[model samples]
Target: MGAPESLSLLNPARHAGGVFVNGEWQRPRGGSRVVTEPATGLELAASAVANAEDMREAIAQAHAAQRAWAATNPRERAAVLLRAAEGLQAHFDELALAIARETGGILAKGQHEVREAIVICQIAAGLPLQAQGQVLPATPGRLSIARRVPHGVIGVISPFNFPLILGIRSVAPALALGNAVVLKPDTRTPVTGGAIMAEIFQRAGLPSGLLQMLPGDAEAGEALVTDSRVPMIAFTGSPAVGRRIGELAGRHLKKVSLELGGANNLVILDDADLDAAASAAAFGAWFHQGQICMASNRVLVHEKIADALKARLVAKAGYLPVGDGASGQVALGPMIDNKQLQRFNALVHETVAQGATLEAGGSHTGLCYQPTVLSGVKPGMRSFDDEPFGPLVNLVTFSTDDEAVALANNSQGGLSAAVISHDVGRALALGERLNAGMVHINDQTVNDECTNPFGGPGLGGNGSAVGGPADIDEYTRWQWLTVKAALPAFPF
Candidate 1:
């Protein structure tokens, strides 16, 4: 017989009890909210809705625990992250199932995100040695050294798109830097996030209050970002909310890192391989139901190949399957909610009315909008200017390399862009001219290594999120130490 009902992964009992704070699982001050699967509309779990008071209490706990955590040696901090990574790997299947059900991500995609989280934790564990400062030598018998230090306590506000990955990406580095953390996950997907992270940290032996999960609405988020006890803020969400958080952090003179939304562009040069370009564009546009911040929103193809490219793109988009997230054969799933589906449909209707042609897929069912492709789109249209954070791609034609580059840089957002061309020199030149923080040559801008500094410019965010040594360096600050060998005379 199949596994017993109690032994099945879908049973809610396998999930964590509720949000965790001060090393304990507890309910919110008031009512609760149910977390549901987007694709099937099934209730996955329920979590307490933390409010302002809960946020304040959690911050106080974090502030109290931060002192001792900061005092702990870097080696010990790294050990905690390492242990967390081990625990995450050990419980990978359970975490993946939770993510799949909660986010409606396809089974394979959900599993991949969980693996990525494990890698992020492992990388974070190395921050103890990686965060070491520089040694400067000025003269003999004199020593000057710069050391990276934690920012006391940090507040992290994560979005729902890649709940676990985004949370770990920011929280891991913060914890590794020895700063206590107060994490406020988006209300919609808090169950998976709370369950996965709390278990890992607990298994890693993290000190009480060093890390806490607070799940609630905008009020809770506001409390965390504005709290005086939290010295730093790391946020991932829309530009509107990011601006508000930045303003608050600015008022308090606190450090802040925000990874906001994007209306990213992908340029297809005349010389690009049609087959490869078509494939990459399809993957970049529809991956994760186009919920990714780096998803290619606009495709600027050279006029010479625009028609051919459009045909191929339409064919590819038409074939994407939409079904329950648990199905192995499912490639694309539903949007997070009905509101997003309506917004996407309205954008398509508006774009078509403005003269853009619907090249493929525009059907909808509940929360799922079919993978859509539109052509003859221009800057004046909403699809060209706004971020269609659903599975939609707008195709626009350009005449020359310069025009392609110009069109790609026209948007106020500059998170990421890709240039697909076989010519090395041309691709490099275009890469230099694009206004995005990241420009990929002959490749899609979807994959990012944790070591790379990842963030965007213009409307994207103020600082980088992941990439290079400099990327991870944003997680810390610096302090200088000086010593005098001889006593100096004091004068009043």
Candidate 2:
């Protein structure tokens, strides 16, 4: 079985069954919450819940630590991040299991998430050494310089889907850039998203109060956004929640990076390899149960090849396995919970009733939704308009390249899009026309690399990106300084 046989991987001593703040575990005044494994409906662990007071303490600790952390040698900060990457690698199995057990992602997906988290940490380790400023042109006997400095306390809010990756993508970079961080992971996957990061960083020699893990509810999140101590907020979740955070943060005059979800797309041109495109469609639409923000929301295909692609996708969906992730015997696991399951069912059923054809896979058993395939999905349909955060392969036909681009751009989201065609130049041309943050040619929509700036426009994100050089801009403030031999005398 791919499932972890026991909870042996979790060390109670390390996590302390409490929220991590000031580099130590403290029982949250909000009491404890029993985390349940989404795939099995089994008790995973009892995690501490941070209240408004706890959030205040976490932010205070972050503020206190940031001064010291920002003053440390860049090399020292780099060392901590590098060691944290090593720590993540060392505890890969434990983290992977926690991800699978808590989030309903299969073991393989958990492993992939851990690997991505490690890579991001390694990338961030080098950020401390990157160029932090520039020397500007100066008049004779004067020097002008521009420098980047850390935002004192950064509040990071991460989601349950791909928790480790999302959490660390912001946390590692913020800390590496000499900022202390207060991270609030989604309450559903606290261990993998919050406490586990604390454990790894603490072992990696991160200074006390530098990283605070406060896994709590919406109240805590609201408090973090509104708190003056948190000068910046990096959030990853749905567009609705992102908008609220943005509104709240804006009121506080805080800088915010909103990495929100989207109704992403996978476009298949008539000239594409049908087999490859079909496979990509299936993978993009169903991977991680389609909970990914970049998961293909709509498959826009040339009407000429739409029938063939739909047939292939329908056949693939019929046999794609669905069961408990802990068993490790399935291709797709259960939805995060019954609410998500019901939402998926309602969306699919409503779309089908609205003249869309449910060609394959519309049934469910408990929380395990079948890999669903729908055709004849038009722009106004619920399946086309709504973000399909489930295994629903929606096929929308377009007659021409212009029509495809028009159809793809007819959404509020602009996160990720994929264009598949044998002609590289043609695919690139079409991709350029798509109003998406990231476009893939001859590939699927879901892609991430630490070296690449990742974010999209419109409802998906706020046009600000993260990763690579983007982190330098995202986590720091630029200051311009000029100096002369003495203070220049003004006319008196």
Considering every candidate listed, which one attains the maximal TM-score?
A: 2
RMSD in order of candidates: 2.6, 2.1
Model 1 Cα shift for residue 28 (angstroms): 1.2
lDDT for model 1, please.
Answer: 0.81
Model 1 TM-score is 0.94
In model 1, the runs with Cα more than 4 Å from the true position are 1-17, 137-143
Error of 1 at 284 (Å): 0.5
Q: After superposition, how far is residue 144 of candidate 1 from its true place, in Å?
A: 3.3
How many pairs of residues collide in model 1? 10
TM-score of each: 0.94, 0.97
For 1-492, candidate 1 gives per-residue lDDT tens digits of 122434332334533335678998777784577777788887767866889998999999999999888889878988898888877666667667668778878877778877888788888877777637778775565578888878888888888889888888888888887888898887788766655676678778899998889877888888988888888898888888999999998998888888886668888899989999998998888887888888988988999998889889888877878877767677887888777778888998899999999988877877777889999999889989888888887899999888887788788866888989989889889888888878888888676777778888877788566534653466678889766676567996
Q: Write model 2 residue lDDT over 343-424, tens digit each, in one string.
A: 8899999999999999998889888889999999998899899897999899999999899989998988668999999889
Q: List the residue pairs that clash in candidate 1.
A: 451-467, 451-468, 452-466, 452-467, 452-468, 453-466, 453-467, 453-468, 454-465, 454-466
Report the lDDT of model 2 for residue 44.
Answer: 82
Per-residue lDDT value at 38 in model 2: 78
Question: In model 2, which runs have C-alpha deviations exceeding 4 angstroms?
Answer: 1-9, 13-17
